[model samples]
Target: MAELSPTAGESNYSQDIQVDEKLVPKKGLSLCSTRYGIALIIHVCNFIAAAQSTVINITMVAMVNTTDHQFQFNGSTEQLPGGPNNAPDSLPAEAPTYDWSPQIQGIIFASAAYGMTLTMALSGYLAGRVGTKRVVGVSLFASSLLIIFSPLAAELGLISLIATRMVQGLVQGSIFGGQNALWERWGPPHERSRLCTIALSGMLLGTFTITLVGGLISQTLGWPFAFYIFGGIGCVYCPFWFILIYDDPVSHPWINVTEKEYIISSLAQQIHNGLLSALPFIIAWVIGILGGYLADFLLTKNVRLVTVRKIATFLGNFPSSALLVALPYLPPSYITTMTFLTLSCGLSPLCQSGIYINALDLAPRYSSFLMGTTRGLANIAALLAPTVSGFLLNQDSEFGWRNVFLLLFAINLSGLIFYLICGDAVVQDWAKGRKLTRL
Candidate 1:
């Protein structure tokens, strides 16, 4: 067993690395390989799942109008002369109406996170046991079924709709939770940052597709089509994913000898660690693209991988803290405050390459479990954001927003400090199921 010197944080694979001839190609290191294909598959999986997750938002308005309720656009809806449908002037059959209290609507909206928060860590554990591809594949396929039935659930009653959303939330939470674990096997050592970033960027693409395409679809085709379209996409992708992917290099039938050996050797040095928190996913895509490249670029320069990780973390999150602090004060202009907030969201990418992938950096073996734990922690933040925002937002007052921004600043500051001193790139002792320590 070759071991890297304690003093040097970089890998020493070039000289000492060994490959199994059975798995290695006769030719040499090649750019286009089975690994990149897996990355692309991951991209599609995230894209479909994410699109399914959010497509409901666009369809909500349409759902409200579809079920036997009267939508009055021009004049008051009044019952006229005769009894029932025979009334001389009246138009259709009378259907029951449901009321949406502000509180009830809030509950319905929050139902997904309720499930997500509960299942975050559990999802990761499942990934290790069953394999990440299976876990994510099952989750998405199940979520698609729920989404397709969503309209029916809405019409059945409020309870049914809420139940459906909660289940969807619970199921979808694991898609991301399992990614690090899945990649633990699929990504080659050198390609970890690039591949993780690229595959995860699908979340951004998914959301963008839904927001722009979903809106148009719902408007022209009706609300049910939106769900059907997105859900169907997920349904279509599942078989392809299962057929193509495997748990790790050793398990993949098509992976060549060289690639397998390289991946296995890479895993030997992979350590387990954790950092980074969740941001609203749409905002994460840009960060993934920019941060992934930046981290990989720095790694090539001989900067200690740990230092590179921290730099990405600090660069990504610290400015957002400052920007968030000032956001409330941005001269009452629409664009000004909005711009500040956008930049704050934009800077989040630094952490994508930074602490986000630290789980893989720390412990390649347990990456999925740690990734799930991180996601669950992020879901707590996601769960809390609405409540805190509600408390600080005043429909007519700026003071409410001021308090919110201040709270955000504090949260970012806390994370920044935590990652700066404690963040690491070295493999962790606990990742190997041994004793744990901080260096």
Candidate 2:
């Protein structure tokens, strides 16, 4: 090391210090560190967030499938033990589901998407200043309350129910707003894929768990219980989130120098938009183990991270969409069509690893905001896609479905081209900020 001295240099006054002398040797990576503890909690948080969103898929079935269960509360119908929060084993045989039309059902299905689109942009901006913990926690808690009240809204009338769902959508839409920042604070550069994947997969896991558990609860206790139970879980999780987690390594009380330094040093280097975050679970639900393994395998092979991600995006978008475009024109063969559909829809590992985790690659500091923008955009798609599909299918013919798939194909192709051309992996200039240093 060269020391600065008045006589050594006329203008310079700096000393050269060996970096290694000031650094501690890296410890072995562990699965059960404080960072991971945070990840586990976040995973559950995501699970709650996702379950509330997806449980709707299951609960709606009991409401609509029986057609007879009009939910009249005619005194003859028994409300569950917990009141509106629980549904009976079965609706009375002659009950009708409020004489709801398919169009109304479609509108209800898309309400959350609209609400989500409205808030995602705002949420991202909030996360940057207020911190991820507060934004996500409050958003989730609020969304849970809305879910609990969903059945109550249903009881009032169709318009009331739509209003309730829109609020729920807006609430839940903000839940993902801070996820990218949260990960940057917690994730070490090298371990981001594993840590982020595991944490984010909670939503996917929630979706899966709901399919299994929601059915049993809706079948045995009643459909309202699904919303109640899911909402309650989120409310319960809020305390733990506030108590155990902080914005960054420096603020976390339980972390040690070894881990803190490691995390800080690593992050010092480094969404779904909302739908993107939800994609891994989609792939996992559809493709299962093989897709995940394929993603990890490529990473292990020393492939450039950007190339790996690009490949994943290409795989996810092109073939599947192309298949959808061709399906309507194909010969009448169920096995062939089914095969095409399964591969196209089910296998999406590229999305799981590529677009889903692209936040870290772009700008780690602004990731939350960036993620929010993407999520907002994605919700716009969510809102529009269904409407478009419905419009195309209005004719109730193969031709209508064909048009729907064709539109999707065009959209997918455009996204693929844009991503290929504009997507990147290098850490961007915006992320080189002091604000990100802490979290």
Candidate 3:
């Protein structure tokens, strides 16, 4: 098995040099430095992208008129249960609501995932070919623009809204692969868990914040504001991103040589829903950061890296799946439901340190491509999850929700078992051939 020297691809480095822990420059290495700054900004972009992806989950309640079905009572029309939560009296007289079926709502919800599935792999390829700067930057800006127009699209028609959301998904999907590509250049080996988790924890926080406030925004200012506020934030963020971010440390003028060397040398090693509706995610975010720290701690302690990854994967998947299986059967109480859900969501993030970062270890050179390909296929779940739930729920709400949970449990367990049996952290034979570079 051959491996590229850590410094082989870096500029002006013809010979290998030993780096002492004490000798490695430590100044300008904290969160204040350029690389960390990039991570933080990527965090913000993730926050925006994730918020846009899910805001409709909460806001749809206000967006749809569930009272389309009518009944006769003394020649007066009465509305029956078309969906949950929305009622004629609860919303403003002028407020718009679509006469969409639960199944239609499912399609709307899943549309973005569908779009994401289509583009994720291509986005990864483009990121590698053209650079993440253009791919991610243009995608973010386009997604934001789409988000701002989402309400208008809804007003135009259901098809318009779904099309808009799907387009948003297409563009935003690039972000996942693109960000990973960015990290391939910028992330250090030892700091892999912490940095990756920090960037990803934004998704949880974004979900938490949007789920917590999205409904409130819908009820008070109307659902459009939810779109406007979040979309606007993404638009506002683009200039700063373009100005501050570079695809790799070498190209970043602001980065000092010491940090650049540290990042490149380290590279050799490679590397949510709502309050009340949001509770689980906030817990997950906290646990995710903690899990990152724990993973890094174990790595530093010389734990077999693959072993650490597996343990985290098991902790994340097994318990969470078990809880999902048990949740529906539990006594129907708010506290009981929340407890299982909170625990499930919280534990699931441990995988951030496990299966999530395994690609970087397995193939630093192809990490972005692997991420895009795997995630694109895995998005089949996202594409089907809501639609399946909707169909099942339509059959029977309680039983349907139960079935949904059970199905998830089965799927997650299967994936956990497969990965436990096969996942590896060591670099692969083919991937080891190339030194780290743009592609």
lDDT of 1 by residue, 1-439 (tens): 0111211211233322232222344454545778877878888887787677767654443333321112121123432233333221221223222344323543565577546644444666667678887888888889888888887887799999899999998898878766657775666544555576667667667766776676467556666777888888888878988899888889899888777876786676554321111223334444546676777788899999889988988888888778767754544454454456556766776676678667766764444335434543454454356455544442312355556667887888897898888888876665433222335
Query: How much is the lDDT of residue 13 in candidate 3?
Result: 17
lDDT of 2 by residue, 1-439 (tens): 0000112211111111122224323565457588888878888887788778877656665655322222221213422242232423365332223445333554665566556644554566566567888988888889888888887888788899888888887777678656656775776534554566667667767766776787678667677888899988888888888888798989988787788886776544231133433333334344523544666799899988788778888887898889878876666665565566556755554475677557646654334335434543454453355445544443432355567777888988998999999988776665543221122
Model 2 misplaced stretches (Cα beyond 4 Å): 1-29, 65-89, 92-96, 269-439
List TM-score per model, in order: 0.53, 0.53, 0.56
Model 3 lDDT on a 0 to 1 scale: 0.68
Clashes per candidate (backbone, < 3 Å): 12, 10, 3
lDDT per prediction?
A: 0.62, 0.62, 0.68
Model 2 residue 400 CA deviation in Å:
40
**What does the lDDT read for residue 263 in candidate 2?**
71
Candidate 2: residue 366 lDDT (0-100): 38
Q: Cα miss at 160, model 3 (Å)?
A: 1.5
lDDT of 2: 0.62
Q: Which runs in model 1 stand beyond 4 Å of their true positions?
A: 1-31, 65-102, 272-439
